[model samples]
Target chain A: MPFLDEVEAAIPALRRYAHALLRDRSAADDLVQDCLERALSRRILWRRQGDVKPWLFRILLNLCRDEHRRRAARPVLVPIDSVSEAGGSGGQEEFMNLREVHRAMGQLPEDQRAALLLVSLEGMSLGEAAQVLGIPDGTLASRLARARAALRRTTCRAPDRPDDVRGHRP
Target chain B: MTERKPIDDDLLVRLHHGTAAERAELEALAARDPDIRARLTDWQRQDAAIRALYGPVAEEPVPHRQLRLFDRPARRWPRVSRIAATIGLIALGAAGGWFAARLAQPPARGADLVAEALQTHATYSVEVAHPVEVPATDEAHMIRWLSKRLGHRIAPPDLRGFGFQLIGGRVVPSATGAAAVMMYEDDIGRRVTLFVTRESGQAETEFRYSGNGAARGFWWIEDGLGCAVVGDLPVDTLRAISVSAYHDLIDA
Candidate 1:
């Protein structure tokens, strides 16, 4: 496939991941367009045989980090609580609503959020996700573990259990 | 009693991010342990909820500005021609493979067609600003573009008699090939969609109803094309409109 077509095909996935990362539709799209414009302008530098998806993701991640740094003082956008009331009718009551999860995700450290999203949501393999984040696999694993533990703690807090549930292990 | 192994959160994290084979091994272990099983299910639900929240964005039409980047005159023509030639060769090879697969594969079932149509309807009908890629005022271009993409000549069915006006349409990717979706709206802003696609080598069938409660419609295959007309209208009204749409398509 032509380089442009491959890049084009990855746009939706990029947009989806960006939305998850930033939680702002227009900002996510702007980040995606920036990443794409950078990628396309430097197309000649890319090795055609190398995988394009991860390369695009790496660029997007860097842009997200920069965006976070630039907006460090501004309060982050959180999906409103009423959004939870709108969906998940019928048998879905057992599942945690998106708004709750989104709110929990807001509390996580940036590294944990990025690591969790790339692996859990995008379905990227551990090794590939590590590569995208420029981290060792072991570090990625711990970040993911911490992220999930934190999410569980926040979303389904059990007052009876000790606070050390996060540190407990086999 | 034997010492029971304490459930590990590390392994649970691995389960969420592991490869398919690794996931299978952990899942098997999860099956034998209730605590682990509950945690696994929770993590899975979290993943599902996250996808449910943001997944639809992936399927939305790529905005025109992003697509236009490829059309910019930044590249020299020589390299462009070389890339075009490579793409042509790839297309030729793919077409050959597709023809071979078509002979071996049966046409998709009616349920699959209707499911795809309803999915397209649910996704696009909610858009307030950019529902249709091409507006109805450019009906000729929209028709020509969709017809070329679908490999079948199609005209948007006139629903004016039923109090709906043609808004426009888009060509969405489908299991069979490209599917055309045209949107219509009554003056009150209730929207309806007609989803049409090519279903080669399929026999004609009567209208089949699918969906429920504010999002419902009918689908059928006729003359090698699978078409569904979906809306929130009453059952009798939807049936009448679908029947009209089917005749319009058949005649066109």
Candidate 2:
């Protein structure tokens, strides 16, 4: 397997994770391209024997973090002008049911979102997820739990819940 | 950060993967506590829906600009090909030794093929409208379009005799170049996809059936083009359709 193929093979997973992190297809795509370009340009940094999937994920997450920092420090410019380009596409109807949950997911803190996505969505074990997120396993676990709790803080507020049940565990 | 009481972690895990009976028992126990049941149901639903929604992104074509990374001039090597080859074998060994443990980790070969088919099925099958790139009314144009993109002359077999009519087709990205996906549907709107990708090797054994997730199909290599007919139909029905298409391709 050439190094190129190995990297190419991981592109799908990278794109999927990037889309989940960034919440926009085109933006996620650009992030994936950026991360892959960076990795390919500096292939020497990757050990030959190391699994490239996690390593690529680590680069992707790092880029996401950098992107967040940049957005926070700089008043972000909205690309409102670009909206005209696809304005007529009229966008297909996204499921409103999913929209409710997606909105809640977007509200999650970035760290907790990353942790939950890796373990719960990507099927990664806690230790491997920690390596990709560059955090201790314990921290990852806490983040995962907090993310679940915070996410359900809204959706799980069923009207059916009894008032006294708030004190009990599910 | 403001803190809230932590939900029992083990309970959450069980809710994520617990038996139906266990879940029922838990629900019964929590009947007095609807908050707990709602929370558990929400978590489990989120976990499943997240994948169902986003997993198809993996099948979206990798943009050509990124793929062009390989077309660039080669960088100087460290002569570590030996180590890479050795490590590759070791990786395969480990993967095979404990496939149960690493099933979540993506594999390099047939898994990619079947997984992509499954994802494609999941994506287009659910469309209420515009399920195909080319509508069946323009089947001729669709074939020409896909063939031109794939750089190989291709045609989709007419399966009207079997009650499946050509709905349309599209060109999708594949490992080597591109694949052609021709979709067909029955009267009730059940869709089946015929996937054709150019293979470097000669045709393989007659036909083999394999499945990933909800997509089941019979895949075979014929005249250096690997073809598969995938759908959610039962194996026998799919196999019958695959055989008909296989004969059509051979005749063409």
Candidate 3:
């Protein structure tokens, strides 16, 4: 019962991280569901003193990675127009920018995307993020740097120069 | 551009863990360096955007359906206990009957067919030297030997459509007297066995799915022959392979 209580307490944070990673409400919920199932099934393996949040997060990260691999193996062709917009401030320009951002996130390598989401979106400390990812701190830093650069190139353009942004070679 | 001071990576790392004095020094350095200022501002903006995107999700209500962690353990225990007891009794009866029947008939009817298939499959699948009693290269001999012992003409199921090759066949004693098992393998080293024996008068023709330990068994009987395919594959994939075997072997 105490373990269940601890898991319940962590659900909101898990949902937040999953939402950021997946960028879709339904997918985020599904990821949270999967994480809970895994945690429950493997409860005996969990150490009582170890942080439950990070353990839950590790399970979530693995599930996301597996889902990504499966989707990559059998790539689906989803039309860009059919992508449901997330809850955000609306304008045609803003919509286009958000869509471009989402596409760019997809193009990022898994490690970089994961690192960025953990540090920036989940508000995890660099060390905690590294631990969750099972990667060294240096690798996490490099991934975060690459993710930041990619986001800048994808999302922001000089207001006066649309063509310049499109034409600028990386 | 005038002489621009280089920003230290150590300074940035420290800034993430710095006191007020360290923060001021970093800010002063950023003020003096245009590139550092630009990079720092870009990093901050990206951080803000990411936070904005995901911050509200942390406050959203978590759906109750997703909270499997809260499932009552007490509720699950009784159901598991009931199933385990039922399976244990069935297994004991089957095993005792099988051993007794093994003396006179050498094999019984339905259960021995499944056991033989599983045993033959396990035995030959591991061998690097002599996997099959008769190799696929000698298909004619393999077919004749198995069909004669089984009391019916049978051929190895063609699984080319499923990306598998016929390995060979073997005759093994089953519950119904004698049974024949044919083996097949895919490129990924997955093996499937087709177990067939003569259907006894008491044997019923009904499809059944059972998981004995980690291995899964799918069985059905038709036309006086008992057939069961056993493997460790996922249920859907196992079902697909079993259906394919049925189609090919029955037609053959």
Candidate 4:
């Protein structure tokens, strides 16, 4: 496939990964913008020369790291109205069930949350996720395990689940 | 050599698959150790919750801004020309000033190097990815690659305790030779760059600050090595970061 087309195809996946990383939809897209522009500008630097998805994601992750660092330097003041604003993505009533899990995921530490988001949410293989994250496989696994434990404590609500055919909520 | 675990790889692989065979083996194992059931259940539930929370993002449309990155010509010569113009202007100033004040040599040269460092920072820091030619994921390779290229043993400071993570280092062409810039990001996405080059003429200068508009810089020289720590952070924070890095990288 041509490079741009391959990059285009990966857009949805990249959006998912960025959304998982940044939490806010618009901010996630901004990070994706930073990633794509960086990738486009540094095309010559891409030693691999093909399949820009992983490279695209690596940049996105690094940018997110910078953004996260910047966020840490300031006083955090989360708007209460932000939750209502997010309701437009999906109807609030329809997404009420998802909110619980989202809240739980937010409760996780940044590293562990990103680790979980990559493997499970993005459905990336452990190896690919680790490469995008620029971490070792062992470190990824430990992060996943820790994230899993954290999520299970805060999010597992079998009693609250709807009568879905599969035991899991989509 | 590292010690090997008793569990076979096949069984573990099966456990990941969650197949009937894997479940049976796991059940047997869980019978021996009850924690296995809890761990498995937790892993499964975590997977489901992540999917529930973030699955929709994949189905959403790609924002126009992200798609715009590819709209430009592949190799942007405009930026290159801009940098060249800036360099050209600097050269013109240096040539014009050489006859004016040869006695005030150190400050002018020092200012120029800081400008170079600041320009490099401004260019590369916006990069979401590929900020460093060598990603911090491969710290050893980054250090080794940078060290070899710079013709000096370079140990990137460990700044995790100060809430800064070393993203990696890269080699760039400098006036002297190839200079090394190690990039770091703190917890909130703010970045601080450490600019390093060999001390020319063995000019060992004292630690000093250079005001850079909204950004700030602190530079020092000791034992034929010079470093300038630059960032847009507030002065005190920048000083703290600079001092911490100096202790870990220079004094140590």
The best candidate in terms of TM-score: 1
Q: Which 10-residue span in candidate 1 chain A carries the lowest summed lDDT?
A: A81-90
Candidate 4 ranges beyond 4 A from true positions = A78-97, A156-170, B1-38, B74-252
**Candidate 3 at residue B142, lDDT?**
88
TM-score winner, 3 or 4: 4
lDDT of 1: 0.74
Off by over 4 Å in 2: A48-50, A77-96, A156-170, B1-7, B10-40, B73-252
Better of 1 and 2 by lDDT: 1
Model 4 per-residue lDDT tens digits across residues B1-252: 012333322233234434467568767876775445545555565566556556666776677766666566534324444345345433533223333223434565576667778877887878996888888999989888878887667889877876889998898877767888999998899888898887656554545566545656767664456777888776656666776776556322
For this target, which candidate reaches the highest DockQ against the unseen true structure?
Answer: 4
TM-score of chain A of 4: 0.78
**Native interface contacts kept by each candidate, as a fraction:** 0.46, 0.26, 0.35, 0.39
Error of 3 at B190 (Å): 31
Model 4's DockQ score = 0.24
Return the clash pairs for model 2, or none.
Answer: none
Q: Per-residue lDDT tens digits of candidate 3, residues B1-252?
A: 123224434335345434568668768878886666766776666665555545666776678797544766435433343346345424534334334334324234445556666676677667777666787889999889888998777888777777778888777776567788777788898877778887745544434444454466666665567887777666556656776676556445
Best first by TM-score, ranked = 1, 4, 3, 2
Question: How would the docking of model 2 be graded?
Answer: incorrect
Residues B14-101 of candidate 2 have per-residue lDDT tens digits of: 4343457765766675676556666666666777656655566787788998888766624434335646744543453322323522
Model 1, B124-143: lDDT tens digits are 99999999999999999999
Docking class of 3: incorrect
Error of 1 at B252 (Å): 62
Q: Candidate 2 or 3, higher DockQ?
A: 3
